[model samples]
Target: MKRICSIYKSPRKREMYLYVDKREALSRVPEGLLSVFGPPQHVFDLLLTPERTLAREDIHKVLANLEQQGYHLQMPPPEEEYIEHLPDELLRRNDPV
Candidate 1:
């Protein structure tokens, strides 16, 4: 099936996004979900298909959720290891007791 979708970003979180039918828009998202998701920022509109590939999500799953629940939530990517970003001296000093 082919669907025209609108994607929205979370103002409060990076790399977080929401996708829904363009015609329905925000009306279909749950209030509790919106409460924590914060206000929606329009990202872009796109056509979704089973064969389409998302940058960080499964196209089939996204489309399935959108079909079943009226929307799809894309969470932020997993954070890198804190130690990987820490200064060498900091990691060395905190290595072991």
Candidate 2:
């Protein structure tokens, strides 16, 4: 087990960055770290929300627990651009004819 040197998270960007020293052995990866995407959605929501305020240690615990639970942590795809519903006339006018 390697001690994490630092964890960087950019909420606006919605990501968690883990940094460990090169010397630490990282052979055993946490399980829940990757499987948090299923039925119990709150965990996944908490992870992705930009308002995360957990203490660093608490965050680490949560992540480690997630990994142990076989939850795989994945950087979800970039959020798709929101498309507003425009009236047909407006869309038509905006379109090049």
Candidate 3:
């Protein structure tokens, strides 16, 4: 199915995005989620199809979520080389898993 999608960025979290059907807008998202998500910043609008490619999330999965849940939340990628940030003392105390 073809759908016109609107993407919204989360003001509280960088790189976090919310995709929803443009026609329905945010109406389908629950109020509780909106509270934690803070205010949504409009990102961009696009026409979605099963074969469309997204920069991060799988387009097929995104489409399925939009159809079933009426919205899809794209979380930010984990910090790169996060282990490097750990204190040397902590790294030395633990065995590599």
Candidate 4:
């Protein structure tokens, strides 16, 4: 199956995204989620298919959630993951002089 999805980024959280059917928009997303998400910023629209590959998310899971729950949330990677990629110089910048 194929679906056209609208992607929105969270203003309050970096790398947090919300996906929903383009036709249905945010109508299906819960209000409580929206409150914490802090008003989604329109990012882009993408055509999703089983064969398509996503950089960080599983395409199949995203499609399944859209089909079953009408929306899918993409959360930021763990803080440790971010720290793992920091350059040694940057990591040492906070060291007490």
Best by lDDT: 4
lDDT of 4 by residue, 1-97 (tens): 9999999999999999999999999999999999999989999999999999999999999999999999999999878866666887686897888
Comparing 3 and 4 by TM-score, which wins? 3
Estimate the lDDT of model 3.
0.92
Residue 85 of model 2, lDDT score? 38
Better of 3 and 4 by lDDT: 4
| Candidate 1 whole-model C-alpha lDDT, 0 to 1 | 0.92
For all predicted structures, in order, the TM-scores are 0.85, 0.26, 0.84, 0.83
TM-score of 4: 0.83
- Ranking, TM-score, top scorer first: 1, 3, 4, 2
Model 3 misplaced regions, further than 4 Å: 83-97
Among all windows of ten consecutive residues in candidate 1, which has the lowest summed lDDT? 82-91
How does residue 7 of candidate 3 score in lDDT?
Answer: 96
What lDDT tens digits, residue by residue, belong to model 1 across residues 1-97?
A: 9999999999988989999999999888999999989999998999999988989999999999998999999999887887666798687898888
85: Cα error in model 3, Å:
4.3
Number of the top-ranking candidate, with TM-score as the measure: 1
